[model samples]
Target: MRTVFIFMNEASQAVEIPKDMQFEAVAELEIRREGDTVLLRPVRPNWVSFAHEPTASADFLAERPCVLKTDYFDLSGAGESSEEPGQ
Candidate 1:
């Protein structure tokens, strides 16, 4: 394990992370304190990564007709209700 020093200014504090311990430019992280230890965890985005080829055709949706189904949820409301305990 490596140890780094934290610097403080008049308003805020900063920690100069080494290049090897740095995250991506667009990466998001969450800092939490558990007892006396501080943890840095990455917050993953709700998205999927895909690549597009210039030579490939855009007939993916046309080949699959079942992708246009609109019956994804139950409109009958037969599940558990979301009422509060006191209500």
Candidate 2:
């Protein structure tokens, strides 16, 4: 909706940013060229995606109970003691 002129390798050229655009004093942006058009977009921080509250309930841990006992088998000596019929 806004138009801005960007000059390449021109130090004297000045670009005016719209006042409605809100940003911090210092910000990072990404520029890309698609065909003949150029696109500019803000580079968000990595943590921004995880900034919101989780959709799952907070009592999720309490719903799943832990089992104290587990079953395991020992197969180390099973095949070692068995011999071939020809032997």
Which parts of model 1 are misplaced by more than 4 Å?
46-87
For 3-84, candidate 2 gives per-residue lDDT tens digits of: 8786655666445667787455647777788999766678865676567646767776776666755447766676675677
What's the lDDT for residue 51 in model 1? 35
TM-score of each: 0.45, 0.34
Report how far off residue 82 is in candidate 2 (Å). Answer: 20
Query: Which parts of model 2 are misplaced by more than 4 Å?
Result: 5-14, 22-26, 46-87
Task: Candidate 1: give the clashing pairs.
Answer: none
What clash count does candidate 1 reach? 0
Clashing pairs in 2: none
Which consecutive 10 residues in model 1 have the weakest lDDT in total?
A: 46-55
Task: Name the 10 consecutive residues with the lowest summed lDDT in model 2.
Answer: 7-16
